[model samples]
Target: MASESSSSSSSSPASPASSSSFLTEPSPPHSPSLDATTSSNIDIPVLISGAGPTGLMAGLLLAKMGIRSRIIERDMAPTPDSRAVGTHARTIEILKLTDKAVYEEVGSQSWRSESMRFYFGNSLVADIKPKPSNDSEFHVPWMLAQTETVKILTDAYEKTGMGKVERGWELLDTKVVEQEQEQVEHQQAEDGTTQDVKTTTRTTSWVETTMRRAIEGTNKRKGESVVLGTVDMAGEDEDKDYEVKVVRSEYLIASDGGRSTVRHRLNIPFPGRTRDYNFILFDGHVETDLSTSHITFINGDNRHSVGMFPIRDNRVRMMLDDGTLTQEQFNAREPKTPTKEYFEKLLEETLGTLKLKVLSYNWLTYYRVNERRAAEFTHKRRIFLAGDSAHCHSPAGGQGMNTGLQDSYNLAWKIALVLNGTAPQSLLDSYNEERIPIADEIIKFSAKTLDNGVYQGWLSSNMKRMMLSIVPFLVRYLPNGRSRPPFSMLGLRYHENSVNKAHKSQHYPVTGPASIGQRAPDDILVPFTAPADTSVPRSEYLAELEEDLTDQPIPTRLYELLAFPGVFHILVFAADRLAKEKDFDCCLVKDVDHYQRIWSSRWPGLRGVLESNATSEAMMCKKMKSTPQFMVHVISSATPSSFESDPNETTTTALADREAGFGKVYIDCEGGRLHERYGFAGVSTKKAGGGIVVLRPDTHIGFRVSNVESAAWVEVDEYFGSILVN
Candidate 1:
């Protein structure tokens, strides 16, 4: 479905001879000219007007939901340019829900190293590692060309067979007309009952057409289909259906881009100011022999900055200089100051005269950095905007493409729901309410990065050099304050909603309101019963547990019990009651002694501190000393049966029984009457029996536990408790 090949050089216009074919196709199955009553019977639920990554992804998700969509694109074929090149961990997790193969394939092609070194004039100032912590769930950022990413998405979309993208079709206009009934006279029958006669009324129609010449290779002109229009945008009351005039579906999305035609038609202001900065993007095959595998940023001169990211096999992507340039200057036929020459000078100035050679060129483009946010992303209830249409900011953190793709992903599902009449129109309001704030935040963050100037100054150059020399030591030992930006895809969350509000205040720390929808960090090793019956060795317990708990769900009751509003949960496991008893009996110690030792050691000063302040002593003690007791009560679904004699033996037997009945209980608990009310699903498998699972309000697991003494467990709890309470 997605194949890469050499780009064709031909750029011919459509020929007139092909006009007849465009006009002669069979009438659409449900044309606008048909009677409104008859047309209502056909099921054409969704119509998308773009086939880029966002549109394709939305279509793919719709297909997964068993819904059908038609995508119309103005492009005659897919673009070969490799635009946005970074994929965050959060996107990978979202994709995993519908297409694991695509996730795995894309993940296998990510950049794993931590730091990105910048060489500036006689100095190396900033050694930036976007996310430096090894404890993060998404430890690496992926760098793949936008073209390739779209190719993968297209392949996945086609496999669904529930949708098809029609290239070359464009949207024209939309009009709405109410269906009316004809007046008739009433006649009295013999029984004195009035009989009404029915008559046909005029039906209003919304016509949509596509120009055959607009998409053809030759200058051929022909008008295409006139079909009924679906809701392009909905007003506050979605129940009241309206028609939109679509002249060309292919170009419909252009109105959503920054320079929106629809906005112009409606006389709406875009309402954002553009910053005074420009960025030049160059994509080409280079002849450089630099052996370094990591991305290189050259920052020395205050006037310009250079960033080089590895694309596919041999090609690389480079962004240089900032600020706007005229079209003539950008596309000079003679190429007096080429990108290669610019990079060479930058490398020499920053790295102190390093030998680098230039090879061939592929594509070159320039963009002015515009830090603007739309006043509102929707208008008049008939038009909605997403991606660049809603917000545009500097590409400093490589967030532009990822952010746009995610925007489309969020909108597609809601659109499908509205189209299918499953969700109320109010759901649509959440889009702007949720995403506009994020866009503002992104713009602010990008502005900060721009202000840093470390990516283009002498101080930054020196700092980068020094950091690169000491990175090995810094990464191994002092990794606390020296981490990268927390720009995880999973870090994004929808907090201003009822569903998220129900979560306890301290349930998901690293991934609460601040990090909702983010992938839970991989650092906290989770110990779960191995799905297979093979005996787990003590030495391999933590390692195997980490592997088993990688993507498991956090238990729902955990969030309920913590009772924190829109916060994260940190669960600490103390010594297993049965194991502590065994140790006590073997050493002839009292139960209280064992409890004190386990509580003091695992939870340490936290208990004493809480006890000193009477306000929290009971809760602290319960969390530290009596967790197992609380666990017994919460794990009621396991229906754990305890025996006083040989506590370890009894606990082990009960665990086995719970595992045996796991599937049924999990289904009933997560899907039965109880699960529906609570909105909590059991962890997918029964393997979660003998551990503590930190759950988010959304029921996603953030961390898990088996042994109480593990440092990871302690860290998880501390992290969970440290989240900001909002």
Candidate 2:
């Protein structure tokens, strides 16, 4: 990382330059001679604006791509407050891709546990259980304070060795000067004689050069280069060829927190309402009998919710709502001033007299639930907004910091592409298309969550009162099932316009939210195969295949076997091989044979496609015949219940028998439900070759195809073609 001294002299802003006058005619002037030496000295691109996280991230991406950028920050010193804390799995994955060691060190050591509890007055209601894992669609949520997250990211940025964040420099104004093209004018030309000649004539002309610039400044910081001279905008030397003036960049990303200056300047409307509930958060040391756990959310009569988690060693962080104290009161409360008696009282009121003591208080902050999102995340070509700058909501979901970091993650790659001249500028439009719907959904879900937490009293409390009044027996028997709403961080899915096509569906039947294009879940996948080989099992083969593809070894193959490139997959296992063969063209026997021959011929290439160790005797035989570029496996058997370890054991008997040879047979196994789990309900049992299965790359089903001959290949070809880049 580039380290510079904080001591540096300040530079004054230059005078405002005249704006380009394109709408009016240019004044006639004498052309001045330009010197080649001065003209050649100008840099094509240079520093232009503030050096906040957004700008710095952009600069880092650009630098990685070998582009030059200078970042200027208005802040004299970096703030130490823990503004945002949460980091999403996606962001972690992205950062891991960039710098594995740094990402792991920062992410792994952050938070320890998470749990949620409910309360009704002084009584404990119930502790909420995390949603059961359906598949590897989501992972457990992790928490980290915001200040630490920023420090890590900033450190990574400085380490890139491209540009340094020139703090204390602010953007004052911008003007366009000598743009590539100004305007084109067309006019009618006069004829020799008005009545004698009736010939039409035309003339075209170009407008003069446009120039613009404004003034800004930078504060002195130790150990940094500082310019002492005042930059004068009006004092332009005539020898310069290209107009030398400061101009706005092609794009501006507003990651300036919730109170975004860029969003305000753009006049964008933030649409949403703030909730009345307030929260108090503190970072400090505490000791208690309760061993460290995931997260503790205590909700009861005092109507308070506290989240306590380990940060480092004995240091812990806690978030709780003291309903009695307003934002002002909470802010005014001094650290270490609140006595142990006061903390005990607060805990008794909030957590039903929990036995815990506060050793030290580091930081205390008050926050209100403000659920708001901008109507538009982008404006024109000049400005784009993200993170708290674009959306804000209750910290209950812990989405504030996570969402912002993801915003930068999503936008950074796109910006890098545009700046590097790889992707067209139009690609930027997809940012809004993909992210807006997500923000809107989060807002809706958060609102519902808040409502559920705050409004359940009317019915539950009254019922409890009535039950207690009638008989204590009935009241005691009634299940105390009040639990926190399912706030799994993994629950959030980018079903719409997500690059992952497999997770496009609303939900995954087997694993709940394992939609198409969503992240595959981590699970212990049991494997089954026909013609079971004692040497290698189906699970081993699938595991190898996954490892070969991703490099990272997955413990289980949670996704379907057949997946389209960049799409989801839905694998269907038929009970019998004849039934599977029947789904092909039985009527067109020749065509079926020819296609089978072709598949057999291409089976060898399939070896390359297998993830890892996904080789079986049957697969080996298939590979011997021909290598397919990509092929998924499925076992078929007839005896639904009798079929156990090996399906191929009875394959000879089934295929030789006349009735069972061409008929469909149901197979009973734990894995048989895999089809139903993935929403493959409409199978055509009447005809042998009538059932069709659809697949997405991430192993989610998009749609199924049935009763088709060569059309299946066509569909597969088309789907893969759209996603894979060769």
Candidate 3:
């Protein structure tokens, strides 16, 4: 389980070979039965190659979607290197919805900052800070190393009970093969006897992968948990040879980093330019006069920019251009900057009068930056290239890993629905349609940033300084003024994706300016429900309800319900009680009836509807997760005691109770804060204020349905019908 055990010989060539000999040998402490490597030729619906942050993320997401996958990594242990350090806010929100605990787990070790400090050769240029107020408490991006991010995702995937990552295994080759499977069915006869009645056979295309691993399988990979009866390969080895194994899967996702062997074999063209400068990248402890509280950049005449960002344990990640030789000298088979003295020279030059020194290093390397992307992300709709395999760029602002994380998020659910018969094959096309453009944009922006960062000119440097000086003032005083959206990733949207109806150019009028094809905005909700039996004013008990906080179940937030996995969320903003008429609304139950018919007509096997307003007596018992494909939540203007009692019927009249809250209950609150936010402030209460918001699994608002029973809902059917299975 030690990191050293799985390190590549290329990574630490000076180390003794005997040190890794034990990697293939079995330890005495482990039982021989546990030590034996069992191989089975099994068919998997989804297979992922590479177990880095991207691959691990894809596996975790698929598991949450109720699909199983096998993840493979070439290395025998986890690496300690950290390529990504900034986890952006958009990624944070995405993680929150994927697994509620992941956001906090990674957040605990991550550092957050609202501003950054800049110095031009020891002289302060300006402090660039974002204007505060109004987003979530955890609005800022967190700095966590990529290794730690991988650990968190891997742990979460293991706990899902769907699949495991096969470490110490390499994907040697993959071939498309046609496979046949025979299925059996049984029926009961009228004689009260069971009959083995029917049989069906089918042939399908599968990707057969040839995998290799050490035959003896020496040590368990780092962060590996104890599987009830598995061997911990942590001791010495008697064998050095490897064993070849084969596994079959319907689809293959290649997330094998920038230098992908899969991409190599496929002969895919990785088009882009590689930079000439050799840059020193390191993570280590430093002794410096500059503060480490925020992102600090050392600039010198725009020709040299050295980035220094603080990390955990008082360590820092430093990057500086290695300018010792000419471009021609380096191209003539010259060695990269080898000595630690070169790094010291960089620090001395950038820091100028300030005292800054690197005392020790966790990792250090010199490399040329490559800005490249694969020409295509898919092959035959069965193979996918994700993360580094799809695109690569300078690690400016740590955008590489963050972009890759989004790549997986964009693909997982679409594939999951397809494999399990919940969606159609056509849905998969949107992956390339949507993500490739984002990848293209990130590449363009990162490449430009790198170029402009080193731009040397009379007008540019002075302009940059002037802009930085005034940013804080504008951010502080301007109304609705704040940091740019790109940094927070809130600006990311599918401008013209096949699945999203609205173009990115269109603007949404809702509060938060929520837009279609963009991340859905969040809002608060006040829980509400009228007593099942009587029409009584809530003011009579409203004060008592607030006094005993635990006794009264207050309203929940919009994000809370979206966290429930694998369903489309429909938010119905029902009309509250009429001011003068003072009658409770009936549109909610009617909307429920509309959904019931839709479910019965098209989706009998799927659970999708969650009604928050008036629940029929038959459906008040099913749990949220068990409710299949649709979730319905209501926001009404009425309170618990505002309904008329129905004494004639035996149905329970218990609103606001736990059972009544199955789909969740919410009140519009005094002055109708939420009602106004969704554009239903003052309206006739004679019927439901009919509107349905369709939210995707990723929480992007796909489109809106104006009427639950009109042809608009039929468009909803056509939408899902286009992607979802019949």
Best by TM-score, which number? Answer: 3
TM-score for each candidate, following the candidate numbering = 0.59, 0.56, 0.77
- Error at 6, model 2, angstroms: 19
Error of 3 at 710 (Å): 5.4
Q: Select the stronger candidate by TM-score from 1 and 3.
A: 3
User: Which sections of candidate 3 miss by over 4 Å?
Assistant: 1-42, 132-137, 178-203, 216-240, 323-329, 478-484, 502-512, 529-537, 542-556, 575-584, 600-627, 636-663, 667-690, 707-715
lDDT of 1: 0.44
lDDT of each: 0.44, 0.43, 0.62
Tell me the tens digit of each residue's lDDT in model 3 across 151-224. Answer: 89999888888779889776656655543444456788899888885554444454656555655553334444
Report the error of model 3 at residue 97, Å. Answer: 1.0
